[model samples]
Target chain A: MSKDSNIQIQINHKPTHLPYSMTLAQWVEHQTLELPVALILNNQFIPKGEWAQHLLTDGDHIDLLSPIQGG
Target chain B: MGPSAPDSWNLYDTPMTSRLWMGSSHFPNWNVFASACELAKPGFITLSLRRQTATGGQSYWKLIRSLDIPILPNTAGCFSAHEAIQLAEISRDTFETDWIKVEVIADEQSLHPEGPELIRACEVLIQKGFKVLPYCSDDLSICKALTDVGCRALMPLGAPIGTGLGLLNPFNLERLRYRFPKIPLILDAGLGKPSQATQVMEMGFDAVLLNTAISQSVNPAEMALAFLEAVSAGHRAFKAVPMPAQPNAQPSTPSMDMPIGDYRVGAELYGN
Candidate 1:
């Protein structure tokens, strides 16, 4: 493994690699996710206001949740 | 005559015209769900949050938004207070609404709410400025606890979820209504027929929340209309002051002066 290899994190439980450090806000914009999404990092809710300052770390578990049919 | 006044009611200070609240789930297709919503014109529609799918549930979200009804997001599958509270926060953020249907299931088979956990969740959610509506059993004590914790509305089940049994314990439900006469009691689940909805409404329940009955029906839109009409009829019947039942039958016609005089005299005159 190269020392400069990409950082690994989990998005919606799926492992993904980022070439460089990225803030949650930038990652969200890069993914172009649907509007009205909620972010949960390691089971803690991360408000949209904090996404800009919050950086994705190695082995972080993130959940991107959206609305669906329910009863 | 002109149309009668609408029997509008308030939920958390928001006035609503329809007494029927529909759930957005289990429809064969999205078009059917949309059609049902258009037909029913419910006061509120329920939905939930889930981890993003491949398409990110964009189509579902688009349809829900287009409906233009107040959204009520639920913690349907949460089993603990912590989980329910967390899901509620996520729901509030995603749906942009503080209205949450809190369900903390204790038994998988019965799908009964864990009263303690539910009350706990409601307390935190209400303190957090969320309008909490807990789905509980027909237990008066649990209902009281929920109301004590600042739940403005209570949704007690008619039966187990998706059972379609239709108000298994009317006695308990009646007591619940009697105990909380001022609180809005919405029958939540276990309804299979429109008559059941009407029955509860006639029994003085403020409203009903339906999902499986309409969604799993052979015709979702038609069933939705049926429930709408039933709910309206029930509301009208309740407001119209229906006659009370009596142990003995009473003749509708007046017993005033008649050609045959009295029934006793006629019977005596005709006797052999």
Candidate 2:
């Protein structure tokens, strides 16, 4: 891995096993990946429609939350 | 027997019951939630926002639309008045509504209201042009402050969070009613049965707001309908005050002198 190589990321503090050397679009399009209820990159709320075009990098903290009962 | 007391309640000046105000928590399943709400027919479903999985579609929002009810956003989780103010803004933006159920929880376990924080939040919310409904303990001071600050209504808690107790502080609520006769007073949270709701309404509460009681009932659809009827009965009774019983020292048996058998007194018939 060179200095410019994509780095690993964590989600909801879970250690991501792999770093996406791919574009954000490519990573989301992977058939095995389930659709996330909500995507957060570095605490940013990303629209689901932008998943394909959004890119992921090393050390990016992506967070997801499930819609549940709250009031 | 005090001349058989007649009904004392006045004909008019009855409290008006609100159509719909719901809490969005505690349903075992989405299907049941949908069915129960449909049967209950609430116009507003209360909710507070937390971060959710952005990967999936907006299922919660979609379901809210499917429920066909207006999203009555809430600041339920916020503890401080400052936090509640911020949450209300975000709720308005996210839900796209200015209606906010202001909840300023001071305790984690019971989730009772911090009256000072509630007033603080209501002050800011009213300034911000939000239709605020502060959920506080059954304290008349808090209710009066909320109304003073221009909150649309005051939603006083019946008991602790999810305790399912009903109108534990009726005395205080009565005082609250006496003070603020104009503002709508809704009993929010901790309602376990329809009778509890009826009692609150009978005491002149404008409405009843609940979630878990109806959602967790053995038959949610039936329970919802029961609440509907109970609320209606309470409101009507408040207006009608059917009659008040007079406790007299003398027995109504007439000293066995005049009327022998107008009605049966007990299992044994008299003069038969």
Highest TM-score, which number? 1
In model 1, pairs of residues that clash are none
Per candidate, the number of residue pairs that clash is 0, 15
How many angstroms is the interface RMSD of candidate 1? 1.6
lDDT of each: 0.88, 0.71
Which 10 residues in a row give candidate 2 chain A its minimum summed lDDT? A30-39
TM-score of each prediction = 0.92, 0.73
Off by over 4 Å in 1: A1-5, B1-3, B255-271
The TM-score obtained by chain A of candidate 2 when compared with the true chain A: 0.65
Considering summed lDDT, which 10 consecutive residues are worst modelled in model 2 chain B? B6-15
- lDDT tens digits by residue: candidate 2, B73-143: 77777899988987677566545667888888998888989888889889998899888878888876677
Residues A1-71 of candidate 2 have per-residue lDDT tens digits of: 22434467776776564533665455555524442244567876665556666667778887654434565
The digit string of per-residue lDDT tens for model 1 on B210-256 reads 99999999999999999999998888888886998899988788768
